[model samples]
Target chain A: MGRWRALANAAFALAVLALGGFGLYQVATRRWHVQPTFHVQVKFSTVSGLEAGHRVRLQGMDAGVVEQVVAPGKPGEPVELVMRLDQRLRHLVRSDAIARILAEGMVGARVVEITPGRPDAPLVAEGGAIESEPPVELSDLMKRTGASLQKLDDLTRTAKTGLEEINAIAGSIREGKGSLGKFVGDEAAYQSLMSLTHRGERTLSAMEDNLAALKRTWPLSRYSDSRSFFEREKVLYQPGSRRDSRLFRDEELFEPGRAILTPVGRTRLDEVGRWCKQASQPQSEVVIAAFTNDDHDVDLAEVLTQEQADSVRKYLIEKHGIDSAGWFRSRKVAAVGFGTQVLRQQDPSLAQLPPRRVEIILFTPQT
Target chain B: MIARGVWQLEQFGRFVGFVALTLAVLPRAVVERFGEVLWQFEQVAVKSLPIVLGAGTSVGLVTWLQTHRLLVANGAESALPSFLAVAVVVEIGPVLAGVLVASRMGAGLAAELGSMRLNEEIEARIVLGADPVPSLVAPRAIACALAVPLLTVLIDASALLGALVGEVTAGKLSPLLFWRDSLVFLRLSDVIPATLKTAVFGLLVGLIGCWTGLNADRSTEAVGRAATLGVVRATLAVFAANVILVPCIQLATEALGLGLL
Candidate 1:
């Protein structure tokens, strides 16, 4: 009986030890339905709530366990996590795969979630580092969301203020306070403007009728032929161009108070003739104007200036053999005289240089 | 009022002295009567296996049922085995084994010692030149201490088995799958400390039972009272020790960088 008791004790002790040893083995090797696993590392900037022994999941399926978490030791170095993933799921952990620390549930355990890379991507090498995204902090998200809401509030307030200002302006316009209000609300002013516009329209219509009549007349008919209605009416007092004008002094090109060209004038005219031949286009127009500062005898000064301009035209046509009929595409070369009318009002320095002068003006129509 | 308070303080002092003496005599007892210790071990561990198994299975089944309902509501019914495994191995198994031992074995030890005291058997042993501590207290304490951890292991295994049964019955989980899932959350850090703490529970049960029994008056009524006092005190000590041990274990694991807690 004593021997039986000892045997019973030994058996019980052996059973107990076996149970304990089994438990220890299960815990140490994690041998329950164990599968082969491979090691991989992931690096994170901040792992805050993640720890070693946390579950590692592949596309939300349980695949592995976190073996170790090495915290950042130096500045700018990321926290490294060593994970042992099941060999069956190794294909999911490719070189381009990303690992993120995520919560299982709102208040449940945190897990490492591995997002599978493209199938064509190379398999992750043993112990290779996988990319890691740090856990999203609720507080930081809230702060950013709060800032966006604040900006939205401010925008709404500003829009409201702008709408109020627009309303005020509309009210003022309705009350006939500003110019636009008068235009919209004052009946007398409105009638006066209407009448003025009507008169202007009538005047424009009459002017059009007169211009039509002038175009039908002998000399101007040729100028109005083939012109579009949208073309602007040509004005006689159009601005002059200093760049296209060539000036000749009376003493250099003509005898004092005389209309005939001198020897010196012929030499100057020769240069002008060459310039006109070179610079003038087929459609260019030229004007020759002569001015005299002999204000004591206005009629004589005018007659003398006209004669001198005519002489310059004659020299350009007769002496240099310039074409008068078809020169510059049938545009006539005109000669005009102004007797002391411009010299009295001109700059004193320019008036002192030469009182009697002629100007050759060139006109080139803009295409 | 003053006299009552003084008597209570004296009782407290004697309890402390008894615990110290038991601990001091433990090595000598083991060295001298190793065979006797093994016999006591068989009594404490082997005899108590059925009760521990029953309690563990019941606890695991109840835990699975309740946890399944809660987790199913959240679409997490699959996590039941993992949750049950962690709950049982880390906490429920060891604590339940400790309490069961304290209630059943503590009462038995107290009654046996109380009867011996009442029948003057302890005095007879002293007269025979045997120290009561090594001959009596040491083997019981050592056996209790040794047995509890083993019993805890049994509880863990039985609880896991119960969890498997529950999973297979309620869900489509196979036995192998359930076990695999169960071990998902089990870690050495949590298992080791939780299981070892039951040894402390065992020591408390032995010391308290022996002390209560030896201190009982030499009467039949006192023997019965000693048994009741032993169960109540030992059960209370188990719970109290659990509260202290859990935090101490947590602190120790944290200090060692285990991070189990």
Candidate 2:
């Protein structure tokens, strides 16, 4: 019985050793599954917290792990990453697939996602390199957005300031403050406007008469030859009338047959005798300035003549006819008061002029 | 002064006597003459098997149930085998064997030594010039040191089997995968450290038993007191050794760069 008991104990010991030994043998030589899996490589400037065996996911589904990392270049250049994917997804991955890192949640792990590439792209191979963008970290995105918002705020402030200035100008017009406001709002503006209507009619009539004179003198009007003759004739036959005086200042402004102005322009009568001597002098390079009661035109015609006034009239009658003078009498100008008010309000310097007469200055250019 | 010197000499003589007598009675001679040690082992190992197996199985089952209950929720059920195998091989097997061996052999050693002191047999040995320690304590120490490690191996195997059964029942894994894949982590580091811890446990249990027994006085109460001290000290020493040994082994393995884990 004791021997049987001893045998049983030995058998139990053998069994225990066998069990442990078998387990140890299996542990030593056990083979794990190694399938051929698809993978892609990405490069980054810095992979801050990334590590091998950290999750690689598609959308949100975990598909692989980071396999290897290499820093081939100097520190600032991109760091390359190699990832190993599961075998099941080999068929789905393509060459042109764009992979990017994405945040999983408000504060969760980072994951890689392959946004499907163009459908026409060729199949991606195992160990093929993939291009990917780094995820925008929370702090970085916030910093960029904050800067953009600041720029937008500056732009908005500038636009608001511009709008406010425009409003102030418009408000001034509504309150009848500036020249435009007075023209549209004040009763004195209407009176000045009526005066401007009369002045405009007179100026039109004068321009017509000048045009008729030119028409009659057209045959003898050589651009160079007549310039001295006209300058001389004007000096010899100066009219005896105040060129700055208004013909009538009556308050019954719109009454028919009223003359708005009757002024005689200055004539150069002494220049007629000097014509032969001054003929080759290039007419002193004649310059004339024309101003309204408002701002001057700055650009106006200049003329030079050296003929006697009666001789120039005879030259006009012989060269052209009476038809031009009749056309001049009927010319009447419209009443806008546009030039009058500009002179009156903006430039206080021009406020002391005759209300209607246009000023013309003639001069030669200095050498 | 001479009396005090003789008294110290007597204690030394007893310790030497235990060693000499234990060596004189060779294991083969003991087997040939009485077969007492073998008989004692059968009684201890076989009688203790049920409780040992029960404790191992229950520990494995509780570990599996609790760990998988939490791990499955986190999708980490596949890691259960690695968890259970490392835990059992490293810490649980040695600790359980040490605790149990201390209770079984330590108390017995203390009791036997205490009874001898009380009966004046120890005093008789001193009168004869044969010391008491060689006669009484040495054989117990040798036997415990050899036996405890073997028992630990058995316990470890039983517990792993229990863990496997629990894993299968829980439906968290397949029995094939458990046998094939899970068993792959049991490397030499795992086994060597475990068995080494068990050997230390055996030496500790034996030392605590011998020390407490020899210190006992010749009183009825002293016998009980010595046995109690033997179990307490052996259990505490086992725990203290574990605390020191685990970190030491971990550091050594890390320095050597020997294991994958």
Mind listing the fnat for each candidate? 0.50, 0.24
TM-score of each: 0.62, 0.45
Model 2 chain B lowest lDDT segment of ten:
B28-37
Interface RMSD of each: 4.0, 6.7
**Candidate 1 residue lDDT tens string, A245-278:** 6799887788876888999899998998887777
Give the CAPRI rating of model 1.
incorrect
lDDT of 2 by residue, B1-261 (tens): 999999979976875665455556546434543345555555446666777788788787778788888878887777777668767766787789889988876787787778887898878899999655454444455556556666777777777778888887765678777655455345665666776666677766766687677779989899999999889988898889888988888788768754432
Candidate 1 RMSD computed on C-alpha atoms after optimal superposition onto the true structure: 18.6
Q: Supply the global lDDT for candidate 1.
A: 0.83
Which pairs of residues have clashing backbones in candidate 1? none
* lDDT (Cα atoms) of all candidates against the true structure: 0.83, 0.60
